[model samples]
Target: MLDHVQIADAIAESLITNGVRTGTRLPTQKELGESYGAPRHSIRKALDLLEKRGVLGARQGSGTYVLGQLVDYQISSRTSYNHNVRRLDASPTIEFLELRTRQATPEIARGLGINRSARIFDLYVLRRSNGEPLCLARHYLSEDRFPTLSEHLEVATGISDLLRRIGMQDVRRSNSSISARMPAKHEAALLEIPQASPVLVLEGRNVDAKGVPVEISTSVWPASRIKVHV
Candidate 1:
């Protein structure tokens, strides 16, 4: 009897050999088990392992489907999600989840160089490629510095666009730190990944031409879907 690892390897090879198209759903666990001469439990474990490896994705109440190629995302002085996705011939869109003013925490205060508990504009957005959720980003901006930020966001395309509209022409990345960990429940649901799947966390601060911190952001990406290039 083949173990789960070996079963997963076999299934992956079958997918490639059969030229299974991306987004094509696989057979049910029982069907796969019968075809592979393995038990249903072993088939389930193999599916799970394949999902974690980014070769497949499981949809709730649906079935497992083949995933697309990994996206190459570059980190540089000026990193734009839209630009990056477009460079790979993919359509990119941003969904603004929230825009609110809130008191800054100790970490936020330090990142933005503001007083603790200072009011800041909390901007939350979900970015997608070809309608597939790819990243969740949260941006903190000092409200006092840009009192009309909310107004601009209402009509602007994105953070960078709004900043330019408000007369910030020269904005660049000042610093960045990358880390990895398993996704949280909410994060997993939002990014449409299994809770057991790992995610890449990017924390960074953007500065203006004057070298003053303008935006402190935290972005989360599904590790399986994204390949970060520093």
Candidate 2:
């Protein structure tokens, strides 16, 4: 007569006590049910709940596997995704979702200190750690400063490298703002998390050596996969 919640809690406890590392595949639903003295339906429900909590991932046709631990993200004036992930002893990667030039909106213009009608290079990037999607970001840069930036930059190199390649080696973070909210449908899909899951929003501007605003970006991180430290 064990409830699914109780079964899930017991499984979690067993995982901890048995030193179940990340990527360790759990037993089959039937096996788990037999071990816990519960039905297969209850065991499946328990695994589904664990998957929602980011504790496990259930692959189609494959069994559920542990998802290991969350990454500790340190917020600071000098923020670097690569550096941050490396500090956690993990590999970092970036994927470009968008890259194009368009007329700046009022908000984008204000953030980059450009005219509303000015052309801006808009880049949407997805960042990952240890092959897991961590966040999605949209960055805006004034096209006038780096006329050929669109041709030179690649998602793999990131914005910092792009600035350096364009002779803006001394760029630094000018300001930042942080907030929290549930993810949008598209964003949740990209992050591979539930739509009801919360995300940490970070908005910031970077300035060149002369303190001229050079770039502005907004990034959204899955709340469950990151521990933000100020």
Candidate 3:
């Protein structure tokens, strides 16, 4: 007889093999036990294990559901979010939330190699894959360098495209650091995940062909939705 751990492994594998979509409600405990030919207690244990692994989630008074497969996102010299999603045959979209000029903080100044209190363009955007929110990004760019950035960004396709239009032909990530933590209330709501769920924070600096800092970006991603490849 299979133990609870074995049953959990089997069910997880089945979910992958069957390509179960995220948010798809799973079978009841009774039905799962019958299908797995396991005892009810064993089925319950297996479901608990899966939930802990982030492969499944339970809704209050509802039922368990598949959490979906993790999307592979690469952090490389030339990282493009749209390209990454497209490589997986998924559609990607970026929605601009806010754009304005603001004084650079000490941290932002250091990231952009600019003086603190200098004017900078602050842009906030939400990234989505297949119509599901994937990440929220905050971008900082020197206002002096791109005075008309706001006008271009309002109609631009993405950051890369906007950069190209502003005469920055080559844009690349100079450095990136990743960390994990529980999401804030607004972040959880935006990502459509539970507040208890963790999120991956990616801090990245991008440069032009001349190696001059162009943009400082901070992105938050749902831990269950993406696997970062460094």
Clash statistics: count for each candidate: 0, 0, 0
Q: Which regions of candidate 1 fall more than 4 Å away from where they truly are? A: 1-48, 52-65
List ranges where model 3 is wrong by over 4 Å.
1-69
TM-score of 3: 0.79
Model 2 clashing-pair count: 0
Cα lDDT of model 2 by residue, 67-156, tens digit? 853566676767887887787677888888889999999999988888888999999999887788888999999899889777765533
Residue-level lDDT tens digits of model 3 in 1-230: 88998998788767654546678899999999989999999999999877865678899899999874446788899999989878767788889999888899999999998999799999999988778888999999999988988778667888788888888888999999999999889988888777877788999999988899999999999776676789
How high a TM-score does candidate 2 get? 0.74
Name the lDDT of candidate 2: 0.81
TM-score of every candidate relative to the true structure: 0.76, 0.74, 0.79
Cα-based lDDT for every prediction? 0.85, 0.81, 0.85
lDDT of 1 by residue, 1-230 (tens): 99998998788777754545568889999999998899999999999898886779899999999885346778899988888878777788888899999999999999889999689999999888788888999999999888988877767777788788877899999999999999889988888878887888999899999899899999999876666778
Positional deviation of residue 44's Cα in model 3 after best superposition, in angstroms: 3.6
